[model samples]
Target: MREQTGLGKVARRQGAATLNPIMLARDGDSRLALYAAARDHLRARGYEQVSMRMFRAPHAPEQNGPSYCCQNDGRIAARRWPALRAALPAHIYLWLNAYDRRGPGYYSAEDLAWLDAIDPWFALNRRPVPSRGKACLAGELSLSVDGDGELARCHFIPERLGNLYTDDLADMLQERSCPRFKCDCYIGYAQRKDLPFQRVFGTGVLARIAPEQ
Candidate 1:
């Protein structure tokens, strides 16, 4: 599909491309944490601008939609990939991700196809990362709020559970826990056993778990 924006011509470049990372999340707080780190990382790498797209899920209003976090303009927040294609830099690297652990069908085949069609640089399906070992997420990797809307302790051994929220941003930032000496999702099975957790699952795998939006 042709982009609606003014960039008229698609400038295809030949050579190594600059990395333009995109992180997606369905949980608001998790999204925030990922985005916060990504923004810092991108800026440090010399990117001056970025874009974010967040919305209510197509079926579940209480939950968030498959969000888009990229180094584009904020105006592209609610728009689809075609619009984004027109706005992104000509020689930039891009990867599209959809957050799982929000339940099933968070991102569907149609959604992924749309992304792939618009940007050949789209990244989604990949060989599953092999399990490394039994690493916990509790305080070692993730931060979650409790049901009472309070920030829980930093480390919970991955067995303990809590309600996590973006509102506890300050505490989330200050708190840090290392349940293991090394944590690597791609290298090992560094995961949490509770309701909400994070890991390196393929986009197609995550989309299959939930209904498409």
Candidate 2:
């Protein structure tokens, strides 16, 4: 999707935040402004489908919390989740399937490899995201852009691709390989305000470094 040019040599020389080359993804409840800006910026560069946008599972219990995407659509929108799935043209699934989320475990590289191969958004028009009722397929496609000028695969979430974490948007875009989805790292760290830092440390890594007891 890079036939044109938006951030040219001038931009690169200027040291602009250049594209992260990552596909930022988020449910309706997350911050999509970054994603939108990324999409617009990438599009300007003559790139089509450089990134993608998607909502979460319509039937997922909202008790967990509402995502930015959810707020965009009304509760009624979710209520019609089934109709939404039916209306969709056979190929447009977002998130992983129930089987994927099944089992007590952490995400593995195999998981990301499997995901990168997904192509759920072939046709771009939909009132609501299709429901899980439909058969699952590999949703490998441009999802959305990152705040940086990079083209992304999705709008709300960053791809771990084998690495447990990926904040580098540039590498994500430049590299098209899917097998490199195994590692463990996430950029910058911060958790919900409600959750205590101790919870994250859990007296493991921190205890070793903190002042002696």
Supply every candidate's count of residue pairs whose N, Cα or C atoms clash at under 3 angstroms.
13, 44
- For residues 22-122, could you state the per-residue lDDT of candidate 1 as single tens digits? 22122222534565787767667655442333322334344244344542222244356567667866543234433433336545788667766664423
lDDT string, candidate 2, 51-110, tens digits: 155433434455455443422432333334445556755434332122222245443566
Q: Distance (Å) between predicted and true CA of 35, model 2? A: 13
Error of 1 at 206 (Å): 23
| Candidate 1 global Cα RMSD | 20.5
Model 1 vs. true fold: TM: 0.25
Ten-residue segment with the worst summed lDDT in candidate 2? 183-192
The CA lDDT of each predicted structure is 0.37, 0.32
The positional error of residue 108 in candidate 2, measured at the CA in angstroms, is 20
Model 2 regions lying over 4 Å from their true place: 1-79, 89-179, 182-213
